[model samples]
Target chain A: MPIIINLDQVLADRNMKSKELAEIVGITEANLSILKSGKAKAVRFSTLEAICEALDCQPGDILAFSSPNPSQGGESN
Target chain B: MNLNTFFKRLIDLAFYLMVPIVVFFPGTILYVLMFPEQTIINVNIPYVENGFSGKALLFSMGFFALFLLFFAGLYQMRKFAGLLLKNKLFSQEVVKRTHKTGTFFTACALGSLIFIGINSLFSYEGKISVTFGSSNFNLLLFLLIVGVLFLLLSDAFKKALAIKEENDLTV
Candidate 1:
């Protein structure tokens, strides 16, 4: 849940539409929508590479990890 | 007829045949309980006098569980064949049906075990002199193994279903 996809922001920065990005990346618009909505369980390396190439953005720009419980830190030592 | 239609027809025939057996079992049980002297299905089961004893109750429970196992197993097979007919493989329905079938088989195995224990009790009481046979023991073992196999299959199907869902969700 901490891993968030900022696909909408990346698309906005690139001034690109989701459908156009999907066409360039060789994925369906529905799948692109799933990615945009952050409902995807995993993103394949090939798919990430394709999306990066299409949108001219790094993977870091699209994916960000923010701790849901920042104070807890999730570390058990 | 083509192979697809042939298999479909075969499953349909099996399902139809099983329906009457499923229907007849409980009906026959009820009839035999009501009129023990009457001949049904060319066999007359003597009525157990003095109401239902613990042994009778357990035996009936075991019989009911086995009937349920047969009904549920056949129903799942029918559903699976229907899914094949519809070309659907990765669905929750398939997973659920498999799990239910496994559970039913497991219950039937346990039920048969109860029957063995009660049979021993009845033999000790001298109400019936029938000894438990090797064939019955083998059948029990077969039921247990089959039950465990189906349970393992259900678990595998569940894992496959999860993978399919994750793959479908991956963008």
Candidate 2:
């Protein structure tokens, strides 16, 4: 829960639709939606590489980690 | 030669066996009920001297209900075996069938105990007391234990299926 996917922001910044990215990354739209919704348990390195290559973004630009608990003194949202 | 393959084949055998068992047992019951005198089912149990009285009919009907419940349990077992053979281990259907099997066995256990208790009460000529350590009592206890075990297994299957679904949907 601490890790958040920034795929939507990256997709928007690149002016690339999720469907187009999914096609280029060789993954289904449903899986892309899961990533976009931040519901994925763990992304494979190959998938991460494909997404980064498709959007011309770094892994850091696609994923961010913040503490989920308020007491941890990090933003959850 | 492979163990997993052998296990799967065994499950397949079990699945097929269940079909005949469910069919034959119920068919046999119907045949016996239709020709009670012709069948050996009532040979062990004593018949009323006045012939099949109201109480005898009630007893027969009760036994029929119990037999149906037993067959229903086997039916659920058949479904579970079919699913297992197909490798649909973590599906909702498997969980539901497992739960149904457990419930059916539990019902059979309770129904048998109640039937025995009522039979003993009616057959007794004098003051009533609960019988202990009888064969029927032991069978009831065994069924109760097995039924509870299956219920626990069903709960475990439910939890495992939920986790599997979550993992599958996680992408």
Error of 1 at B75 (Å): 2.2
Go through the candidates in order and give each one's C-alpha lDDT. 0.74, 0.77
Per-residue C-alpha lDDT of model 2 across residues B43-91, encoded as one tens digit per residue:
3343444554566667766876776776677678767776776788888
lDDT of 1 by residue, B1-171 (tens): 666566667868877887877777677666656775764443322224644345555566566667777667667766766776776767777777767767776777777777677667655754654446666767777777777787787788789889988999987
Q: If you assessed candidate 1 against the hidden native complex, which CAPRI class would it receive? A: medium
Question: Best-fitting candidate, measured by TM-score?
Answer: 1
- Tens-digit lDDT track of model 2 for A6-72: 9888888989898899899998999989888877876888999988888888999988879867787
Supply the TM-score of chain A against the true chain A for every candidate structure. 0.88, 0.89
Over A1-77, each residue of candidate 1 has an lDDT whose tens digit, in order, gives: 67888889889998999989999899999999888888899999999999999888899888888777879675221
